[model samples]
Target: MSTNFDEQQWRAELEGHRDHKDDFFATERQSPIPADQRDAFDGLSYFDPDPAYRVEASIDPIDSDDTITMETTVETEQEYERVARLAFELADEERTLVAYSGVTQGGDSLFVPFRDKTTGQQTYGAGRYMEFEVDGEVTAADTVVLDFNLAYHPFCAYNDAFACPLPPEENWLDVPIEAGEKLPDA
Candidate 1:
């Protein structure tokens, strides 16, 4: 119930998730890493878990039946419905990012692809993604946790053979988010 207890629980969960992903990337048959290189694969690079990057934002639903086409790393393109806008504060700055319900998401989860000041520098060049489900009955004014600590690189960042959608400009943030998965070591 204490802030310290909550922080400890969150850090442990995040670290465990990262460890599982490292194992998957290294040893799984369907891993992004080529078979020949799996032996030398250590783990994906990640910024240290920082609680400041975990945030809560209200969902502003997009009431129209509109969609957006996203450019991809390869020839194909992806279409997603702009489901909502999430406004949250990070480092004392108010920021907003669009959330989409794309073909790839199952259930009530929303896909949020974003590029920040860290892109092409500290993290993957194409940007990273976050996904969160709407728990319980949903409403236009619902609040959801946007955990940047769990943001991950697109598959294309690991191998060019897999095409991945680039984040739309509206989701681009001017702030540097110093959390989540970084570009893996070569």
Candidate 2:
């Protein structure tokens, strides 16, 4: 849905973002890369950035006060508000993903965790995630950008001590998303 787009600018920005993340993983103290491995960590693996994976989705706001307790990687749970459902098409298939507000996690951005057909093989086994901030509040039928190229593995993918919420069953997709971070080198 990204017609009238600037490919050069998008690629440049994406590269910069990846560079910054690599720097953090290689040097930052709060980075997910283990201290012992940081010295040898070159960078995280990623699928080549593809513009096709970036699509505009219509938001279907959940009117009721619905909440869900997501199972985490560390056998704990995290709560989130069912903010909205994002409707979009990927690989010629109608797909929908739930966008959540991590209220219990004290996060300010909209959280979206998902597992595509590529999961467990090409990317993180548990799944990958995307987060974006809405200017005000989500409104039904509002178009929002869903950039799968920005999907990332949670910190728990690199370290088991950090608990990461798993995507809900509804967010699991039958399509393959070949964009985004891939399984870290074992």
Give TM-scores for every candidate, taking all chains together and pairing residue i with residue i.
Answer: 0.92, 0.95
Worst 10 residues of 2 by lDDT: 133-142
Q: What's model 2's overall lDDT?
A: 0.90
RMSD of 1: 2.3
Off by over 4 Å in 2: 106-108
Clash counts for all predictions: 0, 0
The sequence of per-residue lDDT tens digits that candidate 2 reaches over residues 1-186 is 667789899999999999999999999999998899999999889999999999999889998879999999989999899989999988887789999987656555899999989999999899999999776767634888899999999999999889999999999999889998998652
Cα displacement (angstroms), candidate 2, residue 106, comes to: 4.8
lDDT of 1 by residue, 91-144 (tens): 788899998887555468789999999999889889999987887634544788
> Given candidate 2, what's the lDDT at residue 90?
82
Q: What lDDT score is found at residue 142 in candidate 1?
A: 76
